[model samples]
Target: MPTVRSVTDATFVDQVLLADGLVLVDFWAAWCKPCRAMAPVVEQFAAANRSRITVVKLNVDENRETSETYGITTIPTLRAFRGGREVASIVGALPRKALETRLRGVLGRGAAQGPID
Candidate 1:
């Protein structure tokens, strides 16, 4: 099955900010149990929407710069970005249904445009 990919502080701009579609960024840490618990839900979402949306996970412990830039105060925070700016954010380890609802909201906001490099 398809899965969420990992992005580092160095790659965040190219991988997410400049991406061509909706991107769900999962802020997480290796030692956080909630982060681990939500991993599968993210991957499943990614797999199901592989053609329309992109899912990426950023390790907060390792990518402190990106995490701080995004003001991530909690693990498992899910942020939706399109056209170089953040459109929505959810902080916490939400269940699959809740996450899906968030994705639907993000997708419903219409299409994104232009390259954001």
Candidate 2:
């Protein structure tokens, strides 16, 4: 199974922001119902697009600093990073096809054929 690496405040820079390629950072909290609902969709999306993008989870409750830095006022927020910069973001729990379409638009169809690096 594909694992969603937990990103903390300390490692946020190295693991998500500073990383190259397309990185999808899911900002979530344990108690949020929407966050919980989006978990499986995010997981499956991560697995399916493992070669096109890097999917990571950041717990808002645990990574307060990072959450504040990103201005994540929502429970489930998805941000796309490329070249150490945020290129796009989506808030709320969307369906699988919608999520895939968004990712494909950001990463491109050709990215699916190659490694995530």
Candidate 3:
């Protein structure tokens, strides 16, 4: 199943910014409780929206440049990019429904479930 993948500063451009469609990036750290809490939801969302979106994770500790460039002052920051441009962002821990709502809003209609790649 398609799921979240780990990304680093070096690969941020090609893996995210230059990607074709919607890409949800989870900027997190190992020690962050909220980030850990949201992991599974992100995975499930990725699996469900495999065709519409690509999900990825970036560890702040390991990728300082990317984090700093994005001005990620908080862990668990979820940034959504579409067509090589950042479109939305969310910070902190949120429930599954709320996360889904946010993603749906960003995705803008067309509710269909497809197996992730």
Candidate 4:
């Protein structure tokens, strides 16, 4: 089973931005209802796309610096990074199809062609 790894301030750069491959980072807070609701969706999405992408969670409460740097005012902000640059972002809880569409666009048809290299 796939799980969202909690990232902290200390490891933010290495875990998210500096990482290779497509990194989907979810910026959220524990107290936020929307964030809580989106957790399962993210996990499921990660499980399905484990070979194509890297999904992670960053707690705004614990990683204030990164949250502020990213200008993440929302409780649940999802960002997709490729080659250390942010390529796309979405806020709020989105349905599975919508999330897949966005990810597919980022990963490209090459992703569906075969398992991630």
Steric overlap count per candidate: 0, 0, 0, 0
lDDT of 4 at 100: 87
44, model 1: CA deviation in Å? Answer: 0.8
TM-score of 1: 0.89
Q: State in Å the error of residue 97, model 1.
A: 1.1
* Global fold similarity of model 2 (TM-score): 0.88
Distance from true location, Cα of 52 in model 4, Å: 0.4
RMSD of 3: 5.6
TM-score of each: 0.89, 0.88, 0.88, 0.87
Q: Give the per-residue lDDT of model 3 (tens digit) for 2-82.
A: 488999999999999888778899999999999999999898888878888889999999999999999999989999887
Candidate 3 weakest ten by summed lDDT? 108-117
Q: State in Å the error of residue 115, model 2.
A: 22
Give the Cα lDDT of each candidate: 0.84, 0.83, 0.85, 0.82
lDDT of model number 3: 0.85
Pick by TM-score: which candidate is best? 1
**What TM value does model 4 have?**
0.87
- Candidate 2, lDDT over the whole model: 0.83
16-92, model 4: which lDDT tens digit per residue? 77887888999988899988888888998998888888899999988899899999998799988776678778888
Question: How would you encode candidate 1's per-residue C-alpha lDDT over 24-66 as one tens digit per residue?
Answer: 8999998999999999888888887788788999999999999
Candidate 3 runs further than 4 Å off: 109-117
- Candidate 4 residue pairs in clash (backbone atoms < 3 Å): none
